[model samples]
Target chain A: MKKLSETKEKRSNLSKRIWADRQLYFMLIPFLLFYVIFVYKPMWGLQVAFKDYNIFKGMSGSPWVGFENFKTIFGNPYFFRILRNTLLISTYSLIFSFPMPIILALLLNEVRIRKFKSLVQTCTYLPYFISTVVVAGMVTSFLAPSTGMVNLILAKLGFEKIYFLSKPEYFRTIFITQGIWQNAGYSSIVYIAALGGIDMELYDAAMVDGCGRWKQTLHVTLPGLLPTIVTLFIISVGNILNVGYEKIILLYQPATYETADVISTYVYRLGVEQANYGVSTAMGLFNSVVGFVFVYAANKISNKINGMGLW
Target chain B: MTMRTRGEKIFGIFNAILLTAIAMVCIYPFIYILAVSLSDAKSVNMGAVWLLPKGINLNSYSQIVHKEGIWTAYLNSFFYMFMGTAVSMALTTLGAYALSKKRLVGHRFLNLFVVFTMWFNAGMIPMYLNFKNMGMLDNRWAIIFGFAINTYNFVILRTYFANVPQALEEAAKIDGASDFKVLLKIYLPLAVPSLATVALFYAVERWNSYFWPMILLKSDSKIPLQVVLKKMVVDMSSRMDSLNYGRDMTGTSEDGFIYSTMVIAMIPMLILYPFIQRYFVKGVMVGSVKG
Candidate 1:
């Protein structure tokens, strides 16, 4: 009887607390409903990837054909090409674009002139705010054969004006260069902040030890930046497959598709443009699973190396 | 300051020169586009318009102002930016405020519920189908309500809210203020800078949005400025000879029209960039510290 009374009292207390926070709970309803409908509902809709979806019969009435779409995608040679393109572009980004911001930050940090540093930062960061469409558009125009500035410069230098966009060989270079130009400065903000946080005492200690600027950077500054770099590198590894398909879709042509097309763009072409729903969803599911595994594995490795992995 | 060594002086001069060169390279594209847009068709075709306008003309600008779809798309973009940001702010603010309170029921679970969406999502087709199922296809609500809350922005706001003093809330509560009243009377005022940062993030996102609007909206009339600009600037790039615009107009050219449209599309962002710049460092710093 005493235990039952204690349980009832606890239950009443919970109810009373809930009642007191009713308005707060009410405030969360719209956001929760949004998540339920838009976010969680899509997870449920991943079932269509497994099922042979019939548009007329809707998502529920679709027949299950476990892994058929996956098998079909794997059987195609084009799928392998897409996968290669995705990996190549991602790896190129990692190798080239990843180190840019760090280099930029280090370079900028060594500048004693505040005005020059700020001006450089402001100019470099401006491109990041420009729409992807505009950037791709500018890229297209700048590489145009006849009237393009690049071609004009080449002609002035006595080299033949080449159509850069149509050449598959030039696509990856253009893409990677454009990525660096657009993002490097904006991305340097984090590293700049990290640089600011390095202890001044340590720098003074290094100075007393007869260190030059370059030696101080090598010993003290680099060590201070190591944690931030490791964390960012891990995050970049996790995002290896997500190569901004929006820009690719904007920039790439049919001629350059061999080198430029990535998995997401292919999924878009199949699912939205052609209305091949089931196969496309399966492809998308594959992409998501691979991305998730990469993130999970990277997180696990980071945790093993240092106890600072994202939980 | 210590006396500078000769090597240090040389390095500083070289660094200054290199940084100046980089800044010039960065700004050159915008200048080229602007110059090309303003130059005469004849000069542009002659490839003489480099770095500066030759035979300057405002015909392209005039044509854009008078164009049928351009103004409509511009208005549509502004509408989306304002309306989308408003809805997003409401959802994010309410959600952040609720979750920031440690005493809230299911606090840990609710926080997890939101943050989990950040790490994983069902990808494009599933999301597209969900929109199709919800009757959001070709709808403005697909653009607005479809992406009402970004997890990063939500996390930023929540972190800001979590750092607010508990004593202020208690004091408000003692004065018989309700939860909503306390939030409005106390928290909202203090969180303006953070709120502005998130709002600008959403607004700029809505403004620059191309992919979803291109995919979701089927009708030409419903498309945003970015889509319209894409059709003009990018689509026309491959088929330059097929461009039929400005043939009758004296000073206008195919590239000029395209470049002008890009400039107009870029104008709003360039105007708002200073304000956006101020908040970016602060917002990113705060977000990195807690989120």
Candidate 2:
């Protein structure tokens, strides 16, 4: 009875303290309200994924049909194709585009002239800030079969013009290449900052041990950058399925859907364009669940391996 | 600097050449687009304009400027960018300031609540439906509020605010200043650099937003520049051959007109880029290191 009275006293003291800081709580109300209305409320709307939703019946009135939408999604023939395309594009990006920034950072580090290095960095980073709509426009104009610069060059060399954007086989290559072009320099900023953090004493020690420039880079520099590389790799793996669909939607046509259509775009088409809310939300929810699992697994693995992971 | 060996000298020279070539590859496409936009209709149609404009003309730019709906799109884009950034910065600053207080009740829970939104969201369709239900569809507020506060930017700003010395706030309090006064007089000035960085990020994001705006705003007059640019490019590319037959082939080809629209769309970013380049790099570094 005495312990219970002491606990009640502690609770009153805590409430008093909170009351004293009511101004701070007042300041936080708008932010909390924004999140509650904008972020959390929609999460409640995600329940439509499991329901047989009707436009007239609304969210609460819809009848629950558990797993039917998921079944239909799995049973559909286009599901695997889009799933394959999404994974293939993301994996290709991981394989091809991930290393380009590191390589560019390394190359930029080797530059002796400061002005030249900054110029190259600035020029390369410019494309990253350009709108995706403009980039898509440029891509189409540059690869246009009849009047594009690439086609013009090919004709000059006596080669037949290839319609690059329309061909399904070329979509992945174009997408990955554009990804590299747009992001390599911007992404390299992290590695460059990491490179600056490396101690100069290590380089001096390597030089004392008769290590050449290349040898010093190989032995000391790479080791110093290993942690950063590993951390970024884990994060990228977590986001492997969450590629931005805006650029793909802008660049793709009906002819290129065989390779270009990913889960996000497919969901957009079905849910928004066709008004098939239940199935699209089901697909979106599935994608998010898998993404959550991937992130969880990646974080756990990274923590176990290196004591570092995004929390 | 250490004395360079012969091999190091050779490597430096080779590196310079390679870096210059890479820079050219990065920049040449924009130059080509500019050239096509400025070239005569005949040269552009014949694909003769490569590295430079053969015949300079301003017809494409003039035509695009005089085009209906294009000006409204530009105006909408500017309004969205400025208004969205202002609201986002205010909300982010207030939230970060309040959450930065360690003694604030439920700070941890609030911070975690904000962070959770970063990893998980309601996805696109549900978000659209929610907005539709709120009567936000076909409204400019939909675009503005759709991306009101980027959780990543919020976290970074919160981290920045937390690092401000407690002595400053304590001094203000001892001087009979309230919490609001302390935030305005003490924290705001100290946090200017970080605030600028976050604002620049918000501005760029709002400027580049396409997906959310495309879904939310239905009216052509209210649509931003990107959606219109997309429609124009798609239409022009698909009907390229038809343009050569009977269209008034004057100073600019149909392709040149499309290129001009793209250039106009890109010019704002290109102009502001150099000014923001330093801050952008600093912002990214701060976010990555401390995030």
Candidate 3:
């Protein structure tokens, strides 16, 4: 009886505190309403993925389809192709683009002159600010077969001009290289900050042990950076399926769809252009489910291993 | 400079050369584009312009300035950037201020509610359908309210707000100041640096936004600068008729026109970048560290 009364008193106290801060509650209403309408509402609307949506009938009036949309998407040949392209592109980016920043950071850390170091950092970081549209524009112009600077250089070296953007095989390479060029410097900032936090005494001890510059880097710098590197890597892995389609849409043509088409772009084409809302939503739901699994698994594993997760 | 081994000396020289090369590689494309835009149409067509203009001319810039569509797009982008950033800052500030208070009822739950949106969403198609159903299609509000408050920016500002000295708030409370007044008189003033950083971020994001604007706005006049530039540079053939530059001007070549448009689109960012570059790095670090 005494325990029950104590609990009742605590509940009343909570309500009284809430009443005291009523203005704060008023301040929160707009944000709460925004999330309900914009974020959660669409999440609820995702049920149309399993329905036969009709334009006139609306979301509520759409007929239940019971996995038909998912079945159609799975059976379509384009499904596996785009899926493979997304994975390959993401993997290529992970492999080729991820390490450039660390290497750049290490190299920059080696520089002794402060002014030169800042200059290099600023120059390399500038590209990250350029708009994707402009970047894609520059890429197309530089790789244009007949008049592009790249082709011009190749011709002077006595090689046949290859249409870099048009060729399917070159698509992944171009994307990854551009990804590295655009982000490697900016991404290095985190690693560079990490490098600054390493103990000077550790380097001194390594020097006393007759370690060379490379050895010191290998033993001291790499280990110092390991936690940060692993944390960022796991985060990247969590986003494996979310290779942005904006750059792809800008850079790709119909001829290059074989290699460049990812799930996002495919969904955009179907849902927005072709107006196949049901199938497009189904594919998107599938991508989200897989992405959630990846993120959850990555977070769990990183937490177990390093005590650092994106939580 | 004091007692370095031969290996260290060699490494320094190599590092300097490599960094210089990397810097050049980063800046060369901008130079090339500027050169092409300034060169004569015939020179650009023959690919004679390499790193510098050949027979310098302002014909391409003049042509772009004369185009009605580009100006409309430019005006639309400015409106979106300013209006969107204002709404975003207002919403984010109010939300962050409320959530920053540990004593606020259900603050933990509200924080989690906002943060959860970052991890999962309805994805693209469902969102499109939702917006379409709401009659936001071809509407600027679709772009504006579609991304009113980035959850990451919310978290950054909340973190900053949380760090404001508790004594400051307590003193204001002792003086019988209301929560809104405390926020206005104390917190907002103290958090100007962070607010400016986040505002710049929102501004740049709105300026560069294309995909959402492309999907949301159907009419050519309502499209933002990035989308307009894409139409000109990438889908050149399809949009050429819509451009209506006339057959006479077309004889001079469209390459110069495209390059000039790109340069124009890039000008705002390049101009603002140096002044805000320091804050950009700092803001990104704040997000990364706390994120």
Best by DockQ: 2
Chain A, model 1: TM: 0.96
Q: What i-RMS does each candidate reach, in Å?
A: 3.5, 2.8, 3.9
Runs off by more than 4 Å, candidate 2: B240-252
TM-scores for all candidates?
0.97, 0.96, 0.96
Interface RMSD of 2: 2.8
- The Cα error of candidate 2 at residue B30, in Å, is 1.7
How does model 1 fare in lDDT? 0.88
Candidates sorted on DockQ, descending: 2, 1, 3
- Tens-place lDDT digits, model 2, residues B1-291: 567789988988988888888888888889999998898888887878888997899888888888888889989999999999998998888898899899987988988899888788989999999998898999998787767889878877888888888888888788899888888888889888888889888888888878888888899989998888888778755665344422333334677888888888888788879867878888887777534
TM-score of chain A, every prediction, order shown: 0.96, 0.98, 0.97
Residue pairs clashing, model 1: none
B163, model 2: CA deviation in Å?
A: 0.7
Ranking by lDDT: 1, 3, 2
